[model samples]
Target: MNRHGQRIGEPASRWRMQIVPIATVMIASALPLMLPLVASSPVLPPLGLLFFLSWQLLRTEMWPVWIGLPLGLWDDLFSGAPIGTAIALWTAASIAIAYLSQRIYWRGFLHDWAIGALLVAAVQALAVFITFPHAPAGHMLGLVLPQIIISVLLMPLFLRLTGKFDNFRLKRR
Candidate 1:
């Protein structure tokens, strides 16, 4: 034992092991707001959601369901969406994925990507409805459809990045 009562060879804490994953997701969540606002139509993928799901699928045990509350709230604040929207959706998605991952024994990257596509399409479509309730369906779909496509297509990249982040976080100092 050392002066602080911890074992001499033991780490004081393993906080750094968690920093990379959480930071990546948080930064991805805030990406849209970091850009200059010039486009008449939505173009950026829902990177926040994609990255969040990527982490969840990559490591189901890394975070608890409630983790979504704070992360989603952060996304809402930065994405200019109403508060509570992301909180609810992200929390719900977390719970759902936890359940699904537990129930399924046969899993692979393509399976994860398909699940991500379903969630992304649904969530992105819902966001459009919430953001433009008064707009015609065709107009809203036109604006968000491309974004959904991009988000779905980008799922693999985010998933791979999550794996890299996991490896980086676990690397020996």
Candidate 2:
């Protein structure tokens, strides 16, 4: 008890967890830049988007509607995609998730996974559309499909990891 007589090792309240998401999202946005680019298949799971969704779904109260713009701009700078593409998509996804959370009370791993899949697919589709104007539609689909599948399959893992991070953030001495 530093001052308030609270236990030293107790976890923080939900209100204190707000900074975790924004910091985590910012860090995640920069991750792809550190990865070694493969010439054969340029597709990699979108870790930034995955973490953003994970934070939003796991702790809906912490995510503000306007958080997406700066985070998306960060992603656009590093992701090599056109400027404003991620800004629009991330903001839209956040709004959609906010709406869904308001309307639906029941949420499970499967439901979260499905929503993640749809969102990831949408982002990937738009990425292909914006980045590869000259490529054939069939080719774009073939390329993006793998990344989408990988991102979807990894959602649970990302969620678990996000939870762990939250735990770490809230943990006391």
Candidate 3:
């Protein structure tokens, strides 16, 4: 073998691979608070959902179905949402993605983006409803529209971020 050659069969640490993606998404749940300052309105996108979608779409088999339970619990703690909100939503999204992946073998960037956008919008809608249950429908949607738009726009970035993190996680060490 050449000096620069790598052992083809050797793999990176399994523990690292398992932890990196999940840990990153859990951390992403706290991203809004990590911003330099708080905004007056709910402007920050739902980042935890974005990261979860990225990992599921970009590397479909990397996570198990039950993975969402713990991940969502972590998100709920940081998100000021009801304790079970993220848990329910994240688990549902996980199951949905897993189901879709099994039936639809063809997935491209645009396909993933469309899926992410829909999921994000749905999650955002639910969040708004839960937060402002008594508010008018139009007002509830207005509160979350910017957030939904930002999350949709950030889909590509999170997808790229997931790709990079996946590479880092699997890099031979």
Number of the top-ranking candidate, with TM-score as the measure: 3
Name the candidate that leads on lDDT: 3
Q: Tens-digit lDDT track for model 2 on 67-128?
A: 78999999999888989888989998899889989987999988887887888889878878
Off by over 4 Å in 2: 2-16
Superior candidate under lDDT, 1 versus 3: 3
Q: Residue-wise lDDT of candidate 3 within 26-74, one digit each (tens)? A: 8899987778876767888878889998998888788888788998899
Give per-model TM-scores: 0.88, 0.87, 0.93
Off by over 4 Å in 1: 1-13
What is candidate 2's TM-score against the reference? 0.87
Q: Which residue pairs in model 3 clash with each other?
A: none
* Candidate order by decreasing TM-score: 3, 1, 2
Off by over 4 Å in 3: 1-6
Q: What does candidate 1's lDDT look like per residue over 34-129, in tens digits?
A: 888778888888788888999999888989889889999988988877888888888888998999998987999899999998888888888778
Candidate 2 global lDDT: 0.84
Please report, in order, the local distance difference test score of every candidate based on alpha carbons. 0.85, 0.84, 0.86
